[model samples]
Target: MSSPRRRADLFLDPADDPREGGPSLGDERATLTEFLRYQRLTLELKCSGLDAVALARRSVEPSTMSLLGLVRHMADVERGWFRRVMAGQDAPPYYRTDTDPDGDFDGAVPDPAVVADAWEVWRAECAFADRFVAGAPSLDVTGDDRGELTSLREVLVHMIEEYARHNGHADLLRERIDGRIGQ
Candidate 1:
């Protein structure tokens, strides 16, 4: 019998992955944005076809890292680096509090409404970040992050790294949930 991971439909063929590196390379901005876009998409792909219960499943005990929690956490991350730090807006965290700093992940319950809300907020924050990056005068534009002046370029690189690391976690989590795995 074929294992679920070997099921053709559960995983995309390697040749068809959008993140597959191409022969041609673009400028720094394009390259960074493209990488970030695919990393974000990978997170979505990892969590695809799962219900709220599956989305919020913490297969790794003592760790609150669920797919749903990742989404909420990324939303807060996007809002912080882009809106609060770069855009100089007073935007607070979407799912964090002083008393509950890990609210994003801890509050990732298996509720349909919570899942939907997390997706909505995450998407909105992503859109905001895209606009902010596109409209920035230069990647060298600096932002004050807790008394440290950081450039947009640094933030972009950091974000890409952050997503890539989390996506690795997502891959393991997805595999635990179902034998599905790829990319």
Candidate 2:
């Protein structure tokens, strides 16, 4: 009938899944955290074991997307929503600016230093976000998104959506690179 849904080559082992054992049946905050954590781990897994060149390899012509770009982009996203918006910090973007709107993707060169910096920033931002969420009194904590007062609940959901979408992209990108595939 149908060929196997998964390719026999390079799939992630179930035992290595980072999303395993999260509070799937927990309350809203726990659920959101679990989902976000899954997405974050998926991003990391997809990018694992690649050198700077592979990390910066473009997916296709006219598109600047790459695994390295995704890492940098997520760093900015975590910083933006969690620190700047939610915590009202004065932090600016890590990889974007007024002149370079796509700096995250565009600056993803095949340089080990760049890749290392991106990972460092992304991990730090994630840690900060985790702290903010844990210390938050409630998901109802309001943050100014542009001009509207948005709740932490909305931001968490949006972050999950963002990572989910990008992780899909990462899956495709990684597959294109080395035939790796999995959830």
Candidate 3:
């Protein structure tokens, strides 16, 4: 787990093309946000065109990693990082509680409503995170995390890393759910 912070470094310079991987050539804030968005989009792409069954299929036996579960978990993560930590709010866990921390992944059943709700929550959280970053003053802005101050730059980088890691799981789960592969 990492601390979240508020920062407004999402200014896209007029010269830098936002389409390209912002890491290659862009301002620090734009690059970080772009990369994070890319990873988030990758997760959505991997889950696209799938129904409840496909989304909820536990492709990896002995492990409960499913597309639906990933969406639910990411929704929780986004809410935890952005709403709770960054905004210093007491937002309750979206899917899990302290007693049942794995509820997000465990409760991912093959139901259309469950899938729909997970996607909706995930998208909403992502949008909220974007808006939070957009409204921040600077990447240097700090937030308190368990008594420790953390910078927005660190949170953004950690978010990108988190999505990339989960997207790897999504790749495997997607391939197992359907024969589709590549990118």
Candidate 4:
């Protein structure tokens, strides 16, 4: 009998080849925003149509890199850089601490409620970042922290990088989960 399809195979469209087109940007701000938006969409695409166990399944050994963990981590990262670092707030880290650095992944499980919570937090953070970026003049603006400066450009770029890195992990994890591969 045919094996179950891998989660990665289901998310990434292997039929679509990577393009070699030149970059398109009307301005730096627009370009950065677009890139960030694309990455976020890619992440969503990866997690789409997944059940609680599928989203939280650990495909690799000795690692806890589930799709749900990625969502939680991204949520924490968004709040950290935008709300805490950029806005200079005193909020605590989400789903992690010094004692449990891997809490986010460790806490990830095949629970429908947890999956819903992760998505909710991630969507809210995305909205917050979008609003902040829309009203900002430049990515190079400084926060209240002395010697600390950030631009909407830099944050967006970093977020893209972050998503790309995790997506790589997702690719393998998904592949292992079902043997689907390509995109």
Candidate 5:
């Protein structure tokens, strides 16, 4: 039997380059979409070619900043913001965190199946967010709750910022894992 594929391979699909055949950064739709796309691409680039252990490896002491953790965290963020906050839906978090707030990272392990599940969930959440945003009204759209008014533009910008912050962490983690750099 062929040896089992690495866990990180499940999350990192370098075959799908986010920058492939896309408009130049200066082109329209390059404002929010481009930044978000680049952030996602950077995350995947940071994760590529790592084994399960490497993906889940914690380089810094007392910090569980693994690529796997980032995947799980992003999944939760997507669901929280787009599904719950934006749509006003009540849903439980993607990962359990009653005992430890850092359960997302703490629970991540060097397992191929677990990695696969994380990627699947993250991709699904991304798709859901995309669909919602595509059909969503103007950025000035307001929720039923008057206090929750926010433009879709603001949410998209916030999402990009979120990815930017985590991608920075991913850069360092990936470098520590395999000396790879430069998006």
Candidate 6:
């Protein structure tokens, strides 16, 4: 029997990723925020042009991750960090619960409405995160993350890291769905 197709074989050249204007070098705050924004856009770009069926496809056998699930998970991440932790607002999770911890991935059904709602919630959470960052007095501002003290800079950096990692998964997922890969 022939070997299964490898997703890694489908990667487009790294240079093919759409280049965003690099963050400003002079200002520290501007650099952090711009980099975070670029990472966020990268995730969006990876998911663009995909349909519900493609978005809901899991990765190779063991992992249940899907592009739609990533979007949903990120929405909850943004809300959890910015609204619930940083802002100290009592915001409920968008897709997960204590009992159904994997709801984001498990609930990613292949339907147009589900796809649309995933994007909607993701965008809303991103907007809210932007507002929270913009309104903060300074990067040094601290938040209580369940007993640990965290700063705005820490959260922003964490967010950038989070998006970067997930976007890599998105790259593979998109390529697996369609031989299209890259930025």
Could you say which candidate leads in TM-score?
2
TM-score of each: 0.91, 0.95, 0.85, 0.82, 0.81, 0.88
Question: All models: lDDT?
Answer: 0.91, 0.93, 0.83, 0.77, 0.76, 0.87
The weakest ten consecutive residues by lDDT in model 5 span: 5-14
Runs with alpha carbons beyond 4 Å of true place in candidate 6: 1-19
Question: Candidate 5: where is the Cα deviation over 4 Å?
Answer: 1-17, 24-30, 143-147
Worst 10 residues of 2 by lDDT: 4-13
Q: Give stretches of model 1 more than 4 Å off.
A: 1-10, 15-23
Q: After superposition, how far is residue 26 of candidate 2 from its true place, in Å?
A: 0.9
Alpha-carbon RMSD of each model: 3.1, 1.8, 10.8, 4.9, 7.9, 4.0
Return the clash pairs for model 2, or none.
none
> Lowest-scoring 10 consecutive residues by lDDT in candidate 1?
2-11
lDDT of 1 by residue, 99-155 (tens): 999999999999999999999999999999999999998899999998899999999
Candidate 2 yields a Cα-based lDDT of 0.93
- Which 10-residue window in model 3 sums to the lowest lDDT? 5-14
* Model 3 segments more than 4 A misplaced: 1-24
- What would the per-residue lDDT of candidate 4 be over residues 1-183, giving only the tens digit for each residue? 999954433443446523212258558877777777777776776677779999999867788889899999998888887787777778566888999898789989999999999999899988988888888777777564346676556777888899889888877666666665425
- Residue-by-residue lDDT tens digits, candidate 6, 37-114: 888888888888878998999997787799999999999999999999999999989899999999999898899999
Question: What lDDT tens digits, residue by residue, belong to model 2 across residues 47-85?
Answer: 989999999999999999999999999999999999889
Clashes of each: 0, 0, 0, 4, 2, 1
- Residue-wise lDDT of candidate 3 within 96-138, one digit each (tens)? 9888889999999999999989999999999999999989899
Q: Which candidate is the best by lDDT?
A: 2
Better structure of 4 and 5 per TM-score: 4
Pick by lDDT: 1 or 3, better one = 1
